[model samples]
Target: MTQLTTIVISNVKAADETDLCISIQNMRLLRILSIKVTNEEETLQMDALSSPPPNLQKLLLTRKLEKVPQWFCSLQSLTYLYLHWSRLEEDLLPHIAALPHLGRLKLTNAYVGKQLRFGTGFLKLTVLWICNFPQLDEIIIEKEVMPNLKSLWIDSCMELKIVPMGIEYLQNLQQLDLTSASRELKNRIRNVDILKVQHIPKRYIWK
Candidate 1:
């Protein structure tokens, strides 16, 4: 187990948190860890894992979390992260933005916030996907943030009124995908924001 590089645990129960943490603590070489809880309403207490695998690169978690775990700040090597059904109501970007090597991030039904603002950091990110955000109405991507981003996908965010603010700053963006987005929002992008995304080589919008 100490040499394990990847572990995927599905249908995890809340009762197994302790033993799971203990097992993870022993996997010093673990690089990929994915855990999907059996009950979406159950929150896994991962803070007990005092020393997380320092070399972890990809983490996918599907569970209910009251807040972003404090331990996430230690994943300096993480490049890809997927969070589903976290249902958090607070600003989550601040906790993970400082990850120097992070390149891809996917959030599906993970937050209930009204706005998501990417002010700085994420210098190496190349792909970002935001989906199923029930209450999200706005996303602000400031200049100099995620400068290397090449693809952006927004899906099922019905309340989002317009394209991300400062999206034109991403001169390197090559693709944009919108699925199940409101028609008005789509029209806004095609009509009012045409100049903002004209540089993007590929744009896919679906009703």
Candidate 2:
């Protein structure tokens, strides 16, 4: 198992956390790890993974996490990450932005905050997706953050009534997609915020 590079666990149960952690710790070569907990009552106890795979490049977790793990700061090789139903109340952007090699990120119903701010440090990130954020009202992207970002998708954020603050700073942004957004948001984008995303080569907006 030490030579294993990928592992996918479906229907994960609370009782399996201990064994799962032991198995993952032994897989030093693991590059991809995906865990899905189908039952809402089941908790993965992710912190048990004290020694996560050092070289993991992709990770997908479909479960509820009260908070992002402190160990996540150690995944230097991580490039792709997907989180669903975490329902964390904290602003997750700061914790994951420090990842030096993260290129793609997808969040679905992961946060319960009013705003998500992207400060500096996503040097290699190119793609980002934010979806199913029922309470999110704003996203702030700082001037130099995500300099290489190429594609951005924001869907099902009904309360987000304005374009992301400082989106105009992403000179490399090529595509922008908005789906199931508020009518005011779509109107603001087409009328008031048009200049903010004018440089983007592709734009799609759907109510």
Candidate 3:
């Protein structure tokens, strides 16, 4: 009834089959769906999102999800997505990129699968966030796509080495937060408001 522009379910141990069935049953009259999960063990008979509301515009999910099944990337009307806390196949990232209306994305703790041929074109996104992934070496930003990003959060990623060659390519990037890092790969973070770990003085008093 709210046009349901957004819906997020967080830490609902009670998010059982009935809840899933009812949510989808509810989506027929809504526009968005989100779930913050601790596990992906919902009963299949009820949690079939392979074909969703068909009118959804935003779908946000976070926390402890496994590899994203391909059915998710096939949504033609989905324009915004947020997937966090899993080892996402790299190849699938590009598949999500192909959603014709996809516009914004936020990925954290993902494994970006074996298939790497995808493009950032699907998101031509205006905002992005990636955090705490141990395998990320560098983020590859292509100039021809994603020029509208306004904010990016890349944090707690131990293996992340650098932020590619054209840090300046994202012309509109405004707020960038890079924190809790033990190693760094870039000397300057272009022309943006960014925080580097070593540069900030430690706040605690130590003997």
Candidate 4:
């Protein structure tokens, strides 16, 4: 319905896929949409759904997604995004940075990339949280990316050896949070790399 502003669908079965597709396309005023399929092998074909409304602000997709749907980039008004276990087989940072208004992002075992890079733009992003990504070994942040980013959280990435490089340049950064990281990583940050983010207003680390 045109007046519908929020829709959340979970445990979607194979037979109900068609109906969900139709319902999404008709929700012209939708501002929030969250979908999680119970079957890990089945992907919700987001590309087949109609474009979200210009005012839509929050999107969460959990389950097995091969890649982000292109329409997600067109949601210029999106402010919050969470993708968990999405099965993204490519670098998703570039796609996410295109959201002009995005302020918060959380990714839990969502990306398969060994190296996650953020190049130049996420004008409004303030907080980023990532967890449980076993393959992630490096995070690269180029100069001037996410200019307004204020907080960063990392957890349970056993392969990551250190905090992302170039983090010192985030002038607005206020907090750095680390949890469940490998002991070696904790020691590395505490003993050797503390200077990199020492200027940050707050830091929380739990080994």
- TM-score of every candidate: 0.96, 0.96, 0.67, 0.94
**Candidate 1 lDDT score relative to the true structure:** 0.90
Give the per-residue lDDT digits (tens) of candidate 1, residues 136-180. 899999989999999999999999988889999999999999999
- lDDT, residue 52, candidate 1: 83
Clashing pairs in 1: none
lDDT (10s digit) by residue, model 4, range 32-123: 98998878877766766666677889989888785677777788889999998886897788777878899999999998878888887888
Clashing pairs in 4: none
Clashing pairs in 3: 88-111, 89-112, 89-113, 90-112, 90-113, 91-115, 97-122
Candidate 1 regions exceeding 4 Å error are: none
- The 10 consecutive residues of candidate 2 with the worst lDDT sum are 38-47
Write down the lDDT that model 3 would get.
0.56
Worst 10 residues of 4 by lDDT: 12-21
Residue 80 local lDDT, model 1: 95
User: Can you write out model 2's per-residue Cα lDDT over 157-202, one digit (the tens) per residue?
Assistant: 9999999999999999999999999998999989998998899999
| Count of steric clashes across candidates, in order | 0, 0, 7, 0
Q: Candidate 1, residue 191: CA error in Å?
A: 0.5
Residue-level lDDT tens digits of model 3 in 52-170: 67677887665544445546765778777776665554344666766777767777665643222224574456666666667666566665566666666666665665544444565
What's the ranking of the predictions by lDDT, best on top? 1, 2, 4, 3
Say which prediction, candidate 2 or candidate 3, comes out ahead on lDDT. 2
lDDT of each: 0.90, 0.89, 0.56, 0.84
